[model samples]
Target: MRFSRGAAMVALALMCLPGLSMAADIDGGSLSWAWGIPFAGILLSIALMPLLTPSFWHHHFGKVAAAWTLAFFLPFAAVFGPAVAGSSLVHAMLAEYIPFIILLVALYTVAGGIFIRGNLHGSPAVNVAILAIGTALASFMGTTGASMLMIRPLIRANDNRAHKAHVVVFFIFLVSNAGGSLTPLGDPPLFLGFLKGVDFFWTVRHIFPETLFLVGSLLGIFYLLDRWYYAKEGVLPVDPTPDTRGIGFDGAVNFWLLAAVVGLVLFSGFWKTPLGITIFGTEVGLPGLVRDAGLVAVTFISLRLTPASVHTDNQFSWGPMQEVAKLFAGIFLTIIPVIAMLKAGAAGPFGAIVSAVTRPDGEPDPAMYFWATGALSSFLDNAPTYLVFFNTAGGDPATLMTTLAPTLAAISAGAVFMGANSYIGNAPNMMVKAVAEERGVAMPSFFGYMAWSGAVLIPLFVIMTFIWFR
Candidate 1:
């Protein structure tokens, strides 16, 4: 009778539960706000140390990131036993960082292989046309893909010009940042949002007008500036690369590979398979595992298929991608507690932050969401910054898509658009900057770049605030 009663109790408990264990989740309320200091320190190191001591930071950057990781982890492990820390580490690696790096590597390798041969003269019309093309491609191939593909051609176009720096700056504006505003494929933050259940076309539907306005305004400004410089410098009597064989691409096959990348991402988003495995309390969905594996295969296929000559011509190297990987490794790790606190909402230490962006009447304020998300995204990694605010705005994709649509739009726009505010604002910004500087463009210093963004981009964002956010 006792055995029968025990079996019945077990059956009752089983009936009360879902079919499987819920995915591992962090308890933000259990965290201290002080846990964020190392994350902030890593961020500050990323922002300042490079500007302050370029060579030292460049060589020691990996070690610097490691130090910050230890700073966060040692204390974190001490406070919360190794099991909790291990779960957190496993969750960050499997669920977030690995996929993030895989996608970047696949895009970079694929895009790097595709080279546009033949020299392009950086005429105003030609430059504007390229910018327009890149902006359109960005929403599909990703800002990094579009940027890596285009930045070389762009730099080559202006190589003969006396006034070359501004061209690179505008390239950063449109190709590296604003162009990516229309879809999840265009930007990392949006992609992360998509993985979290935001629909594929949600961004294109909501943020299209804002992207058009900003991108259009930037193009117009660049054209006028380029035209004035063209007139001032006039044409050179002897063209540097005077070969008249119009533009032709070197690696045509990679375009299909790029398309496959897009398909895989969309497949993961749409295909729901009940099959998946739990790894360290994290659910590894079947589609995601397949997508990531497919991407790895695509990367190898591109590397093997494309001629080495194309890479040489493109001046392709792995340095920028390496830098992003090392730096973001530390970023993704340190920001764990910060993201946890944010997810805790009003009950957590960061409740005041959530309270700041909400109206007294309990409605979400779009303008505040825009500024708060944008401001942090400008300094922190935009992808995770987007996640933080996305949670703060109520982490429900269906609700965010419909009734709270404006809030979602604000978060998306802020994360994608304001990434140009600083070099460290987005991964591609630093890559573009490093590439431009190496190509002999006298890039603006950190604060110096801010002056340019403040002068050109800030007013436009303000106008956008009034037009869209209001």
Candidate 2:
């Protein structure tokens, strides 16, 4: 019943999506070598997918999914080589998106784990509230913050229970990912968009439907799954020797410190502006000491303000977040050469997508940018992926929009929204998996996560595509 209702709501929401107020048709571009090179690159990546695999490729769905994405984009990028290698495009991407992704990954690692309160059996309503509030909190503090803050409380809530992993999994799907879509402050990609001229309120308002539908439906499915596990596995009662201590100040709320870090992040996002400042006679720029300094300050405050006993009580260690940092740092670095090449040809490759679609005025399709950008985001770091598309959309001289604003919104909506298509699409997916593992929830392998998304997320996106983007 919950699924049906949520799906119905999603379908209805689609029926009323904002239609284009004015139509401007722009058409095909003449071919160039720049376009061809990148298109070939995409194809070659796809062809080499087999070589990138491990012996356990079949079992490791995540690797398989990555290979599949490489396959699709590599071929596509090859055919659109001109679009893949423009220096201007590459520069913009680096200046805009890269630092943003780096900041988010760093923040997640520093915030450590979130701790949840209350047991699972206290009240069904309370459980929902925790999930809802916790997820919302995650978008702001970084998903790791919310995850770290709530996971233990949730575990403790279900401490005497056997069917708890299911709760954590749904929590991953909802609070960790979907819930953060509304604010750039909420998710790295959206936040990048915010830095790039996307109105903060715009993403929040427009994305509400997407977030609500996906989360509500997933939660509904989770409830049913939870019931099945509950029936089969009895609750593990609270430990007789459970540690019961009074709740201390939970005083870690050093608002000014966190705000300072966020302010620095925002300034970094607009690195070209005077808003960029120097502290102690030193300039603080994107990916520079100033930004790192802010993060350092917040980390110190969060650590110092948190009760020493809380760390002991939570069994907290920096290992899991550290691992995420190390792994993603490698990923971000290795992919630089690849992303650089693709970015160089951003325009020409995207032009190829435009050529494929016929416009009503025989004008090239305005939407080619949306699809190309969206398609790329599902594979690359969504923040940079978004900037690539946003720049492309804004760069087109023929685009009818009088200002960059609408195009920015469309680009942002596509990049931030579509990024959820696969596990590797965003940083949070990796973080969630790591946190889940720490909590002892055996999450689905990469492909397994996709299977779940395929079952739930994909259809919802399809509806969104037709209703919002199409």
Candidate 3:
């Protein structure tokens, strides 16, 4: 009954979506600031509702998302006509949202199938090693994948310790956010950048230095803090989850599936094709279609091949993926006008934003871009916030990659790295928190986590600004 209600709500919302015909393009230069209200509202709701009204948000988040989608669609159709609104909706869905969700689904499914069996004691060194390994895996398998795959073992390893919450906090910092900086597959914002024409290896090539610095600094800090805690509150005499078997992987075949996902993503980026179809105003390329279809196949294949015991051991469920899909559906829809207005640059309603990140010489300030993108990414969903800033910095991937390389690097680094600032900042942050709490670890409250980030992450980001963004 619950599933049906949620599905029905999503279906009803889809029914209200704009028509399929292409119409007049939105003139961001002419759009009023009010057009951005729905975008802000939805993001704010995602950030606040879970903290303030957990039960209501948990039960009705999909409904709230749908409501915001309607808020944008109804007003848009009324003011701009259904044809115009439909074109925008189609463009967003076909060009951006579908591809984004498909990749996440593939990653989530493949990652969820692989269960890490057995556990080890959580000495400070062992915890740091787990964090470092998870951090490295994050670049290849995704932050979500690495987090889901590694969080359990880390928790189990530390289950006997009295002061284990800091271990999980560092896991969120290094594995869930900063470590994903090296690859597009590692983070949603980078994937979005890839979808926008940034080269497959562009992020790694540009931000490797920044990633190494942030991740290394985080690991070092976590080690010192964890060492103190370990000494202060020694482990219980008996391990809570003593090793029952040698540490090994269940559903290890998914590693190959993970490799295939990386291959498909790379193939799509490199394989140029003139053959394509048009959907509404957006062109659907052969490479993209192949990529998306292959990803869907990978998702199902993982589900079919993985043993039920592995999934059970992993506590795998579709709940997190479902919530993300529904929430981002609204985010993609509402962000249409915001992206449009941002594309209009200084002449648009968000001219102040443009000016704030601009230098007196009419160029972008990399430091300002870093801080601005990071500040909001700390609060809003980083993926869409990335798109917003990507457009704000003049949305041409080629130009941003070359002439404004520093600006683009700042934006990328900020969006991916500072997402560690809050639980709501990145998807995996909350997931890791929930998993830790489920295991009886007393994870900090939302603001308390912020206190951790502010004390630790903020100083690191400042040093990064001077060394790199400057």
Off by over 4 Å in 3: 1-19, 192-202, 236-238, 384-403, 437-442
Q: Where does candidate 1 stray beyond 4 Å?
A: 1-25, 231-242
Model 1 weakest 10-residue run by lDDT: 1-10
Estimate the TM-score of every prediction.
0.90, 0.67, 0.89
Pick out the ten consecutive residues of candidate 2 with the lowest summed lDDT.
Answer: 19-28
> In lDDT terms, how accurate is model 3?
0.84
lDDT of 1 by residue, 285-357 (tens): 9999999999999999999999999999888888778777777778888888988887787889988877888
lDDT of 1 at 428: 82
How badly does each model clash, as a count of residue pairs?
Answer: 0, 57, 0
lDDT of 1: 0.84
Overall lDDT per candidate, in order of appearance:
0.84, 0.52, 0.84
> Tens digits of per-residue lDDT for model 3 on 266-321?
78877877998886667889999999999999999999999999988877777777
User: How many backbone collisions does model 2 have?
Assistant: 57
Q: List the residue pairs that clash in candidate 3.
A: none
